[model samples]
Target: MEGIEGGGIGGYWWWAAASSAQLAWGINFYRKGYAGDSRFMPLKAFAVASLFVGATASAAVGILRASGVHSVEDAKEVGASIRSGLGIPRRARDE
Candidate 1:
């Protein structure tokens, strides 16, 4: 769970690259009319949604890493604090 400050460049780089590639693929599929075809619409939509989620997660992780949050636990704490600040309800964890 090493972050940017911990020299975890490869992990973040991979996440960014993968997210960009997935988003591009999703956009390409939509532009090619794949979404217009009923058979392909569902799959295309799912792909696009998945890509967006991935990209969002990656960006969040990058931000947290850049802010000196190095471990997963620390990231979770920061996220929780953010959610609380925003008046968002915390999810129940099975811990």
Candidate 2:
């Protein structure tokens, strides 16, 4: 556990790739699934992608904030961005 040195930052890249893949899959699934077959699969894939993106952004923000690199306003902006980007309700702001 001391000399291990292959899982530092590359893990982020894998998540990114998987997220993108899920997003694409969702879109394609939705498009081809418009024939009224199964609607849940597309939504599931899309939600998974959104979750990954949101989680990554949140983690980054936390890391930055903890290191004295970001301000409170940044967190608010990120929250707003995530909500708007995901087409979520905008009236749920805490401020």
RMSD of each: 5.8, 10.7
Clashes of 1: 0
Residue-wise C-alpha lDDT for candidate 2, range 1-95, written one tens digit per residue: 33123334433454455545655655665465444447566876666567556556656644454433346887677878888999987875465
Q: Which lDDT tens digits does candidate 1 get at residues 1-95?
A: 54445644644776667667776876776676653558877877787778777777877766555566878888788889999999998888815
TM-score of 2: 0.35
- The global C-alpha lDDT for each of the candidates, from Candidate 1 onward, is 0.71, 0.57
Sum up the clashes in candidate 2: 0
Clashing pairs in 1: none
